[model samples]
Target: MEEQEIYLLITRYLQKETTTEENEILADWITDSVDNEQTFEEIKLTWQHTEQIKLEESTIALARLKNRINHQQDNKAKTKKLVPFKWNAVAASVAIIGLFLVGLFYLLKPNDSVPTTYSVLKTRAGEIKTITLIDGTKVSVGPKSVLRYPSVFNNSERNVSLDGEAYFEVSKNPHKPFKVNTGDLTVNVLGTHFNVNASRNQILTTVSLLEGKVEVNLNSDKDDAYVLKPGQELTFNRANQRVFQRNLDSLNTLGWMTRTLNLSNDKLSDAAVKIENMYGVKLIFADQPTADTRIYAQFNGDSIEDVLTIICASGNLEYKKQGNKIYLNAK
Candidate 1:
C-alpha cells in the first residue's frame, strides 16, 4: 500500500468507518514492520491530540505548521553546522500540537477527497466481468480474478489491488497516476490501456501495454523497474525473481477479452493454461515431450471441445476426458 492510502485507512479506522475486513487489512499492515507500527502509532497519537482542538482552528494551525516547517528546512539548508539538540518541553509540546492539527486538517477534508471504504469485485471460473471506477476508469476482469478498489480515490493518486487477469482503460489524470498492486509487482500508469496477468496460480506475472506507457516494478525491489512502451510486455518470474521484456502480440495477449483464443507459437503446456482459464477445466499431459510441443492455433468463440480437438490435431496429440480433467498424449 502507498503512504497516502495508509493515511486514508488510518483516518477511516479512527472514524470507526472501516469494515471488519478493512480493520484486518490495517492490522496486518501495521504488524508487517516496525516502521508501519510507528506510523500507525504516530497517526493515532496525533488524532487523539487533534480531537481536543476546535474544528475551525485546523486550517490556520496547519498553515502555521507548514510555514514553520518550510522555514526550518530553509535554515537547515543554509547553515553548515548542525544545531545542538536540546529538549525544551514547551517548544516540543507546541510542535506536537502543530502536527496534531495538521493531521486533523487532512482527515477532516471533504468526503470526496478520500475513500471511506473499498469494494471487492470477483469473477468465477469461465466468467468475465467489467466495472467502472469513480474516476471513470474501466476494468475488465478475467476468470477467477479478484479486484479491490476504493469507492473514491484519494486526491493524490488512484490505487487498486488485483489478483488474476485484468484489462484496464484508465481515464487520463497526469496529476494523479493510477496504480495496480499485484502479488509480486505494481503497474503504474498515467491514463493508459493495459492488460495485467498476475494470477496466483501462474508462476510468471505479465504486464502488457496496449495503448500507453507503464512502469512495472517488483515489490521486493522497487529500483528494479522496467518502463514499457506501447505494444511491449514485461514478464516477471516469481520463482527466479527476474524480469524480461518482449514485443507484445495483441491477439495472444488480449484475445480472452473477445472470446478469441489466439495461440501464436504457444507451447502445448502454455496453451492448456489458456484453455483451462477459459473453460474452467483441467488439462494434464501424459508425458513431458507432449507438453513441450509448440503449436499455432486460433479459435474464435469456439466450444471447449472444439478448441481442444483442433489443438490436439495440430500437435499430433490425442486427449482423453475424465470428468473435468483432460489428459493429453502423443498420437
Candidate 2:
C-alpha cells in the first residue's frame, strides 16, 4: 500500500475502529519488525504535531482573520478607490483573507482526528463532478482532472494539487491562505474565484481570476509573489515556471466549472475539444484546414452529439462517432 494509505490505516487503528483485515494489516504493519514500529512511531509523532498545530490557533486565528476583513470592509466603505486599476491593495488583502478561511478549517478538525490522507478525486474523459472540500471550498472538476488534497488541511496553509482543470470558489479567511499547487507552479489566493488549467500534457498551466484577487508565487521561492486582479490571467510555462500575466474574459473562463461553455468567435477545433471532453468522446476533424474556422455561440446546455451535428452542418463538415471517438471530415 502507498504511504498515504498506510497512514490512513494507522489513523483508523488509533481510533480503535479498524476492520478485521485492517486490524490484521495494522498489526502486521505495526509489529512487522523493529523498523515497522519505529516508522509507526514517526507517523504518530507527525500526526500529533499536526494536531497541535491545528489546535494552537485555529479558533483565535479564524476570529482575527474575520476581523481584519471586516476592518478592510469598513475602510472600503469610507473611501472607495476612484481609479480601479491604480491600487488594488484592498482586493488583494481580502482575497488573501478568503484563502485564510480555507486554510483555517484545515488546521482544526471538528472530529478531532487528524487523518493521514493523500487520496485524490479524479474523473474519466467526459466526466464532471462537483466536490465540497473539507474546508467547504466548492470545486468543479472537469473531465480527466484529478485533485489531491489532504483529508483535512493542517495549520499554516490550505494547499491542493491539480492535474487537469477545475474552478474554485474558495471560502475566505485572512489568517490562512488558500493555495493550489500544480506540478509547475503554485496559485495562491486570499479568497478568490478562479479557474485552473493544469493538464500534464500542457506546456503551461493557466489561472484566470474571476473575482477578488490572487497571488502567483513560485513554489521554489514563495516570498517572490505576483498579485493578480479580476479579469487578469496568469500562465506559467512548465519548463521554467515562468509566470505570464494577460487579460481574459472572466465570464468565459469561469464557465467551464459551471458546465457552461461560452464561445464567441471560437475556432471549430477549440469548440470540438471542449465538447469531446464534456461528453467523453473523440472529435476528429477531417479537412484539417477547415477546422481552424471560428464560430461564435454559447453552448451551455447542449448535447455533444447535437452540438457537433449543428456545428458540423453549419461548417459543411461531416462527423461520425465510433464508441467515444469522433471522426470529422469536410464535405
Candidate 3:
C-alpha cells in the first residue's frame, strides 16, 4: 500500500470504522517491521491530538505529510548512511502541525469518548449466568444467550446488545440511561427491573417490566416507541411487524431466576412456551381447546415429569413425552 493510503487506513482504525479485513491489513502492517510499528504509534498520537478537528482535515493533512516523508526517504535511498538515519524531524513536524490544528479547530468542544474494548457474556444450554456491570447494574443471562457489553461505559449512556433472553436490574442514573439493543428493537430505561426475551426461535420478542419504567423503540424511532410501566409487558411480532401491550404478572417472567416455573393465570399455550424454552423441549397440543386452558400454579424447581403431572392434573389434560417432544391432549 502507498504511504498516503496507510495513513488513511490508520485513521479509519482509530475511528473504529475499519472492517475485519481492513483490521487484518493494519495488523499485518504494524507487525511488518519496527519502523512500521513506530510510524503507527506516531500516527496514533497525531490522530488523538487532532480529535477535535474535522476528520477529513486531519486525514488529508496526515496523508500529505506521509507522502512528503516517503518522497524524502526514497530520494535518500541512494545514500546507505542517510537511509539508516531516523526521521525524528518528520515525526516532530507531524506532531507540531497536529497540535497547531487541534488549537485552531473546536477548542471548546467536549470530546466524546468511544468504547474501545467490549466483553461478551454467553451461556450454554441449561446454563444461567449473572454479572454486575461496571455501572453496578445486575444482569442475569438466560440459556443460549449472548450479551455484548462495553468493559467501561462511556460518559453519554450505558448501552449493551442482547441476542437472546436476559433479566436486567439496572442501576439508577438520571443522567445516563441504559439501552439494550435486540435486533431492530431498542429498550431504553433510566433504572428498571425488566426481563427481555428475544430468542431467535421464538416468533415474539417480549419485554416484561417488573419495576420502574422503560421505553421500547422499534427500529430506533422515537415516534414508534411505547413506554411500558411496571406490571406491563410489550410483545413485538416479528412476522407482521406488529406490537402489543398487555398488563401481566411481571413476577412470572423471573421464573428462571429462582429456578421455579411460576404461572399466574397463564394460558396453557403460554405455559407451554415457557416450558419449551426452559427444558429445550417441544410442546405440542392435540387441540386448540386444550391449549387455551388457563392455569395458576407454582412449581419450585420441580422436575419436568412432576411439573407436567401437576399441570395436567390442574386441567382436563393428559401429557405424554416422546423423545424431546411433549404432547398434550384433553382427557
Candidate 4:
C-alpha cells in the first residue's frame, strides 16, 4: 500500500467513516508491530484532546499537535520506512485539521459540563498512606505506589489511574461506574471493596475482590473482560497476556493494610517473595534445598526478624541478615 493511501485510510478510520474492509486493513497494519500501535495511540490521543478544546484555542492546539508529531518523527527518523514517513505526518495533520474543523462547527455548542482536574497521590518505599477521594471512596495505597485521580469525578463515571498496589473501598453510586486503570488493565465497579497489585517488577497484575462485584478489562482484548464476585481474584500476566481467576483469601489480600503476613502452607521460595515485597528486602538462599522448604505460619504485625525466627524454628532452618539482604539456609 502507498503511504498516502494508508494515511487517508487512517484518517477515515479515525473519523469513523471507514468501511469494514478498510477497518480490517487498518487493524491488520496496527497489529503488525508495536511501533504502529504506539503511533496510532499518539495520534488518537492528540485528536481526542483537540476535540475537547474550544475553537478559539485551536491554533495553539494545532501548534502543540504539530510539535508533538515532529518530536515523534525525529525519534523515528532512523526507522522512517517502518510505517512510511508521509503516512504518519499526513495522518496526524489530517486528524488535527478534522478535529479543529469539528470544534469550529460546535462553537455554539452548549457548555453543559466543566473540565475535570486531576490530582496525584503517591507513597514511597516502606511507606503506606490512606486517602479518601472526593466521592467518599477510600484508598489505602501501598509502598512505592502512585494513584492519579480527578478532584471531582465526571457525572457518568469515576476514573483513576494506579501503579503499584492499593486497596479500594469504592463508594456506591449506581448511576456512575467507578474505574481503576492500571496501564494494561482496567477494573470497573459500581461499588466494591477490592485490592489491586500492579507493581512494575511483577509478571502479573492481580485484582482481588472482597465485597460486591467488579469487572476487569484487559486493554489488549476489550471483549475478554472478567467479572468477579467477593472472594474472587483475577490475575493478568503481563508477559504472556494471559488471564486467570480463582478463589482468594479476602483477609490475606488486605495483609499490607493490617501489617499481617499470612503464609498458609506456602513454600519457602514463595514466602520469600511475600517477605521481599512487604519489607522491601532481598532474600538470598544459601542452597536450593533450603529454599524449597515449606512452612505454614501467620505473622500478625510482627517484625521481619521475628517472622524469620519463627520460620527458621519451624523448619530447622537458619538465617543471617547483612544490611537489606537476608541469607537463609538449612540448619
Per-residue lDDT of 103 in model 1? 52
Task: Kindly report which residue stretches of model 1 are placed more than 4 angstroms away from their true locations once superposed.
Answer: 1-115
Model 3, span 1-331: residue lDDT tens: 7554676676666556676567667756664554665566555544545655775665455555556567767875454222332334435556344443332223322483333578899886567898766555779999878999985565568999998899998877776789999986899998889999998777889999989999999974557879998899999999988889999764567787666787777899988866766666788999889899988778877778888888888876899999888999989
TM-score of each: 0.63, 0.61, 0.56, 0.62
Model 3 local distance difference test score: 0.74
* Residue 313's lDDT in candidate 4: 86
Instruction: Return the top candidate by lDDT.
Output: 1
- Model 1, 130-184: lDDT tens digits are 8766545779999889999986565467899999999999876666789999979
Scored by TM-score, the top model is 1
Estimate candidate 1's RMSD in Å.
Answer: 12.9
Q: Lowest summed-lDDT stretch of 10 residues in model 4?
A: 100-109
Candidate 4 wrongly placed segments (more than 4 Å): 1-117
Q: Global CA lDDT of candidate 2, please?
A: 0.68
Give me the runs in candidate 3 sitting further than 4 Å from their true place.
1-115, 262-269, 282-297, 315-331
Off by over 4 Å in 2: 1-115, 219-224, 239-243
The alpha-carbon deviation from the true structure for residue 27 of candidate 4, after best TM-score superposition, in angstroms, is: 42
* lDDT computed for candidate 4: 0.75
Candidate order by decreasing TM-score: 1, 4, 2, 3
By the lDDT metric, which is better: model 2 or model 4?
4
Report the candidate with higher lDDT, 3 versus 4: 4
Rank candidates by lDDT, best first: 1, 4, 3, 2
* TM-score of model 2 vs. true structure: 0.61
